[model samples]
Every structure is written in C-alpha cells, then in structure tokens.
Target: MDSLSEQQQQASEKPIINITGEKVALGPIRRDQVPLFYRWANDFNVLRTLHIPRPSTFEENLAFFERDVEDEKRRTVVHFTVYDRASLTPIGRVDLEEINHRDRRAEFGIEIGEPDYRGRGYGTEATRLMLDYAFTGLGLHNIGLYTWEYNLAAQAVYKKAGFREVGRRRQAKFMGGKLWDIIYMDCLSTEFVSPVLSKIMVPDEVRS
Candidate 1:
C-alpha cells in the first residue's frame, strides 16, 4: 500500500482523538492509514514480539484496521497512531489490547517505526496519552503489558509511565534460537493518585 491508499482509509474512519503533548500526538487511526500501518507492523524488527499472524497483503491490513477501530466489545482491542505534533504524520502506534471488562484490565503495547523518532520521547508521550484514554475515557480500572526480558528500554519507559512489574512468564518466547521470559507489568487507578494526576486527570476529577 502507498501513501495515497493510507489517505483514503483515514477519510473513512478518521481518528478518535488527536491528543496533543509537547512532543507527539496520539490520534485515532483512520482506516485509510492501513497501508502505512501494515508496512510498519510487518517489519521484522517491529513484529518480533507481537503475537498476531504475519500479514502478507495490504488487504489483511485493511481488514485488521477496520476491526480495530470499529469493534466496541468490552474486550475489544484498540490502536492509535503516534504522530509527530508538528508534521502530523504517523510515526508509530500504541495499542490497548486483550481488554477484559469483567477483569477490568488490558494489555498495552507501543513501537516507534521511524528510527529518527526513537529516543526522542514520542513513545513516552504517546503511551501517556493512550493510558489516559484507557483509564479515563474507557473507565478501565487497570491496564497491563508484557515485554521480552531483554527489552530493558521498553521496561524503563513503562516504569516512567507509572507501570509496576507484577509477574513474569518463564521461557515463554523462543526467538532467534533462544528461550526468553516475558515480564508482566501493570498500573491501577488507585496507584495513579499523585504521580500521574498532573499528566492525566482521573475520571473522578471531572465527576467531582
């Protein structure tokens, strides 16, 4: 898929929000953005830790994009485009997946596709915006995520964003001929009391 194809998808489903911060924006992904998303997601380096099947065609990406933006099930998965605030171009994605309403939890994931965008704080800002949406806009009680043990950079990002390690899955991933454990981390609204209040207001803030 080319850039034109992505523009068309954006017209069809438009983003849910264009969250603005000092460095980046977390916006709703329109369906037209599917092609760009496909390329980023299918990159070998990007999909190294993701669980979805490898997509081989633009059509597969289109189908996935529609499902992600339209589905409203309590356990539904949602994704947002991480865009540069100044240029308004998608540079990566942040996702809240594996949501369980009864359990009041979901798994989070993020990636910066553009090499130049890495280490510039876009991931942190995008994640903060997404977590605000999950905990406040969606009324979720908890959000969680897992990362490969060696992904220390990601762990640091999650920690700075207020997540705490909760558990670890032993030898869960066999990649590049080696076994690796997965680290599970999570954050609760109750825990957000002081640190994140200025960054993202809780739902009660409005209600109160």
Candidate 2:
C-alpha cells in the first residue's frame, strides 16, 4: 500500500466515480480476484478472529463467489473488493450482507487478507466508505455487525465510527483458550457523522 499522503493524492487524480476514500477504493469484485479471495478465506490466521478456521478448496471458493454473485443480483447483498487507491492494488473484501429492503438494514463484514495491509488505515476508511454507501446510496436506516470478543481492535474502530454495542451472545464461541461471547454492534444512518457519502449523489463539479 502507498503512504496515506500518496493515497490522497491518487484519489484526487482518479475519477471521482470510484467509490473511494482517502486510503481505499471499493470496487466490484472481478473474476480474477476470486483466487485471492480463496487464499484469504482459507487462511487460519484471518478466520480465527471471526470463528474457527475452515479451510476451503479452490473449487469451493469459486462456488462461493458464484453464489454471492447470484445473491447480489437478487439484491440480497452489496459486495465490493477493497483496493489500495494509490497503488491500485486489491487488498481485501467488504460487503453489506443480508440486506433487507423493507427493514432497511444489513449486516456488515470486512476482511483485509493481505497481512501487510492489515492494521493500516485501509480497514478504517474502507468501513466509512461502506457506511456511506449503506446509508446514502442504499437508503438504509441501520447497519449491524458482529465480531469475536477478542477482536478488541475491531471493536474500538466500530465504536469510534459510531457503531454502538447492542447485545452479546453469551459464550457463543470458544477460541483462544476461553469461552468468548459474540459482540454485536450497530450504527444508524442518523448516527453516522463522517462526511463520507453524507450526500447520495456527487455534485456536478466533483463528479467528473
């Protein structure tokens, strides 16, 4: 990934049509990126934070993408591949899952699989970009997510980004040598404070 300053400079030069923030750009997942997704999905280090690691075969991973594409077509979810805007590199994936039109709510998930990219501001800004789209582009009222009890860093990011803990599933998981609860966090459109997608459409001056 490029330095934050370089990412900002690149964002200014790229077409604003890219659903991008200062550090990351969210683009539709492509066929070629499926393999990368496969690699990340099967990594124990990454899945451990979410749940017990399940190694997935390449064929299975490909099938998963196929299924997701179908779901997306049905408006079940809006998924995107995360990119480092400055370097134009695919780093991970993010999605607004289980989208309900009537309820105007969705579940959120993100994975920055590239170990080098983790802990960078990419995850943080990618989250904001997703929220902007969920609230403004999709006309959603509430967005929710769940993380493992040990994912304190992710928890902090959610709290700082306006997601409040709503509940916890007691002893729902066993990981890292202890019984851990699944923490639920949510953010309402009204509670989002970032200027990200605060407006649904880009103004004419900035759009081109």
Candidate 3:
C-alpha cells in the first residue's frame, strides 16, 4: 500500500479508546453516521427503550443530529457512538443529555441498536464507560437516568453500574398496549465506579 494509505489503514485498525471497555468502545458521533442514526431512531425496538415513544422521520432525525452537535458545543449535551471492539463496527449509541453544569449533573441513556449485539452485556459496560467519563472526566457530581418500568434488563445494567432508583413517575408512558411507570435513578460521583479508571484518571485539588 502507498504510505498515506498505510497510515489510514493503521489508524482504522488501532483501538481508539475515546471511552472504552472490554467489549465496546465509545467515540464521537460523526455527521456521516446520521443515516445510521436515523435507521435506529425509526426502529420500534430501539425507541421502546428510549424516551421518545414515536417513530422519527428522516428530516427529524437529521435535525436531532444537528441539534445535538449544537448543544454539544454549548457543553449541555454529549453523544457517543458505541462500537464492538472485535469488529470495530458501530453497534449503537450512549449519550449524556440535559447536562446541568451549574449543578454538576447530567442525564444518561444508551442503546444497543444491533439485535445481534443485545443480551451480551455490552450495554452494561458502555454505561460504566460513560459514567467514568461523567464523574472523572467531566467532574460531574451526579448522573441520572430513567427507564421504562418494564425495561427491567436495562435497569439491571444501571444497577450493576451503581445507580439506585430515586423515584418514579407512575404510568407516565402508554406503550405496547399498556401504561408503564418511568423509573428514575441516579448515581453520585462519589458512587461512580468503573474499571476504566485503571486506564484513565482525572485529578482534583487533593491530587494537584
């Protein structure tokens, strides 16, 4: 291969941590991936696990991408694409949303959009990776999330990552022919725990 081509190939092969764990890696959401984003957004199964209950149009999804980027610039939101490490292919996404900088907190959510990638514990690891970034990297004190009451599996993943249920909005969402509560949970910075710390560290005044 030509020298420039070789470097490009090497870059693709190298694991970019961005945010990482054993089975998955998180990295910046690229504009070109908006098409994939739209596909996931329209997937019934995908939206079932997310806050948005209705299917989104291509234009709406595109607008969301643009808006997320804009909010990221203002430091109120951040988005990351999840990748399977073995194949280096994008599988889903996780995001820190509605970030309250003044309160040192943010809301979290994640999805494993690929059917094949589900039920493999990838979501749990990705959650921890994001928590690591939130508590240490961003210096946020609290990270919160809400899951559909029926999404017990997702809640298990959050619990494994040290989150505890703080409250619930009863019968807040009607879906799949019934109503479900919105289970609210949060983890404090002091409570955040992750193996990613072995690879990355952010210090405070005591360490300085």
Alpha carbon deviation, residue 124, candidate 3 (Å): 0.3
lDDT of 2 by residue, 1-208 (tens): 6699897777544423358688888888766678899899988988888766888898998998999999999999988988898886888888999999899999999898899988777888888888888888888999999998888878877776678999999998898679888999999999886456655476667655
In order, what lDDT does every prediction score?
0.76, 0.84, 0.85
Mind giving the per-residue lDDT tens digits that candidate 3 earns over 1-208? 8999997677655535586678998988876678888888878877777766686788998898999999999999989989998787889989999898889999998988888888788888888988988887888999998888999889899998889999999999887799999999999988765578635574454753
Cα lDDT, model 2, residue 187? 94
lDDT, residue 42, model 1: 75
Q: Which stretches of candidate 1 lie over 4 Å from their true place?
A: 1-17, 51-55, 73-75, 193-208
TM-score of each: 0.78, 0.86, 0.85
Question: What's the alpha carbon RMSD for model 2?
Answer: 7.1
**Strongest candidate by lDDT:** 3
Query: Residue 28 CA error for candidate 2 (Å)?
Result: 0.2
Backbone clashes (count) for model 3? 0
Candidate 1 on 1-208: residue-level lDDT in tens? Answer: 8999887776654444456777787777766677787788678766665653375688877887767767744448887788888877779988988887778788888988877887777787777777877776667889988898867778888888788999999998777788889999998977654323345553454553
